[model samples]
Target: MNASADPLVSIVIPVYNGSNYLAEAIESALSQTYSNIEILVINDGSTDDGKTERVAQSYGSRIRYFSKENGGVASALNMGIEKMAGSFFSWLSHDDLFVSEKIVRQMDALAHAASSESICYSNYYVFTDDPADTVPISLKGVPPEHFRYWLTVENVLHGCTLLIPKAAFTTCGTFNTSLRTTQDYDLWFRMAKKFAFVHVPEMLVKARSHAHQDSHKLAGTALKECDALLSGFVAQLGIDELKAGSGQPGAVSYARVAASMRSRGFVEAGLVATKLCIKHLSGESPYTKVLALFVLTRGALMQYITKPIKGLIPPSVRSTIRQWLAGGTKKGPPGAETVRGMGLKEKFSEVYDKNIFRGSKSRSGEGSDLVQTAVIRREMPRLLRELGIKTLLDAPCGDWYWMRHMDLPVDRYIGADIVEALVAKNREEFGSEKIGFECIDLAEGELPKADLIFSRDCLVHLSFADALKIIANFKRSGATYLLTTTFTARTSNEDLGTGFWRPLNKQLSPFNFPAPMLLINEECTEGLNMFTDKCLGLWKLQDINLQ
Candidate 1:
């Protein structure tokens, strides 16, 4: 298209006593590479003795300036939207700056994409002082279709990064005048319903975060608005929307949404999601629901309730009491009794206490042997270097025996184990600022975001059911890669009790994992060197086939 023929992008700068940063925003807009643009400065009742006015007037007809009554930013933006002649609308907060290529890049994206979604947004940088030090906030690795649902989880979008079609305001209606702090997001939530937001995935806008910003100044009001906004968004939300948005199963998505709401201090909103979470969980089969209940509650229940109670009771009486509470556990047929009421916490503790895996009682078993770990120790560092792995989560990091010996190319190392005593020991002995330890059950507890999850020798002890939960936990953790134990030669998979020994082939039957990106064989000596096929398979968590 010719210069004039190209769609005009109207950059709207709304200011309320923002004279200090107004010039920079205006300059950034004026410096845009895309020529077909108009900069409209809407002076939102700035009371700084005409300072903001002079900034706009100094531009001297290079920009269009308009003064409005002392309404909030929403009203100012609405005025700009109504007056602009451009086909597209871009909001530029007086303190925020657009990259020179912002409009052109988004315009190019719109022209090239086959998608019908008219609203376009890109990743933005949060800056305090210099642009170089700004931290980029990238949205979830989801398609444009799920951005709306993802909005239900959390708001990571910035209004300045958006290049909304002018017609979108006409179709979805302009921003809610009543909403002061949450006006942009309220508008976004509405726009998302009518249109899928196309994420450009480029740092197009530099958003300033200062003590003077509205977010900091109006913190109390913002919290109230956030609660109401999210409550309204998630009120009548469904399983399918949450499923597609979170990329998790039905009940799991609701559970996540509930947890997210709780973290944000939106207790009422969390209760709403929690209600839906329970509603969906009730629909599951009786046994599956029971299993979910145990797995979900085990970590917290054991740690907060049982762990303290454990100290009071003798070790000999604890098992008998637990079995009694669970209606006296009877050994059912193998594979049928996959969930034995006892979870990873109890099972791993028993293994540690009894030396069931057959090493020393103080150690983590034969699996943590220096010789057994030699292959991984040698190969892992190089692989981490290649993948640029920074933060690593070694779940079920048993006793820290073999890993402590290796020099890993990692920035942060988190060793998580279900056994509380073991985690405490590891923390007291080896825990530092860089090397941390958390007591978490992979099948139940949350995993922190890391570059890689080194789950060596972890899944082999879990049943297929528990293994599925662990893998799902890995996905939910937002971690990139999973390095877990899998037997390459074992084509057939079998389900076992959680504590029992079984060769798990992640690529086979129940798991149906894709071919690993890399596999490092441990070169087995178990059962007189019988299990030579034992190896750790590596796969991107995203590529794992959940079905």
Candidate 2:
């Protein structure tokens, strides 16, 4: 462990608030069998209960600690890098956990590729408290030539998984502090300019999924920063092309410019560029046109199909959708009288009792029942198992009967409801601890932490903004998986179709809505709208891990 002879690896960690996981990260760094390491932790003016000094003191003199007024993660990282004395440099996010072999494995890969490549990265596993979750793997066999192309489309590198030579840093430069988010991508792009980047193809880090991480809280800011970075890069590329006196623009350059403009809230500019790109490609390159068409078609479909649902959705739901679109917060109200009035509870209860509770006896007379509750009960367990989830936080978990009927692992369950009567009934039936019923309004108050948080058939009753807030709250609580249902069928003034009648035959008795009666009035035809698409979108597992 000689400081001078050993190939010192400087592990720089930039810290902000909520450093609960900092100790784990530092211990992982220290416990690395690769002893020749200098752990440099920079505290970026975190306002969280003296987390900086606490972690530093705990580490004693084993690690170097530097504290500065809040300047942002990039600034803290830059300062850390400048003060480092290691031959190789790497960064570990304050909240992220590194595996014991992380440094040694990364170092080995870098040393092996030292002559040919300047940077190296390894795969990392995503870990959450929820047992049912899958770790997403990074793409393989991505040639360095296509690295820029891949980056322009999506970020492939995880910041915590990267290891680069100090010389690489000297060449590529430190992160841009001015940029709020995507500084890592900005730095990576700069590094790619000079160095060949390679993936180690080994999982060497354990990235934590938790609430309060920068990615979840400052998603909007991050997106904005990414746009700024892209704009700068686009400008640079344009200048370089101009200086080279090349009249023909590069395809990569055009794509990057268009992408940056799109990211920076310049959709019209992006569309124009995309059209020009299509024309250019149509004449000179067919492959580019194909890619453009694929992207365009997908975008158009999403906008067109979801537009109706987006419009019809109550304001609360719309707000949530907007937040998600902005990559900000997510979550919605747990209970509202309007939502309760939807008769969803009764519908769910009846189905549960008939199929789940009574089992085959309840369906002995009926040949087959293929309804929503039956579908939910049959599919939910399979989905949960497939996702590798063992725990569930059934927020506003209406009644314990669903749990009993679903027969999921009820050992680790928290059933919350705003209605005191429902909570009392659940507690009385299932006992307080086993079902753990709580009388809390998720819409108005804080939520408990859980691995997989969900409230079935609850989104429609909430305004969009409240829904977004609920989602954001779940994310903050560090839930890795979410599964909630929303109403998507359109109610219109038209004759009941034979096919529709057969499907909803049982529920037809309760169909007394105004729209069904309005079929005789031609004037009300315009008000009829369909909400046919039920969207089930999840954050890509990789994005969750990276956060």
Best by TM-score: 2
For 156-175, candidate 1 gives per-residue lDDT tens digits of 77889888888888789998
Per-model RMSD to reference: 17.7, 13.9
Write one digit per residue (lDDT tens) for candidate 2, span 285-387: 6665566565554343323323323345554444455435433343312121123333334533443333422233322111122222443453455446546
Count of backbone collisions in candidate 1: 0
Off by over 4 Å in 1: 291-547
Error of 2 at 181 (Å): 2.4
**Model 2, stretches more than 4 Å misplaced?**
1-4, 49-51, 114-117, 129-141, 227-276, 285-298, 303-433, 436-457, 461-547
For candidate 2, the lDDT comes to: 0.56
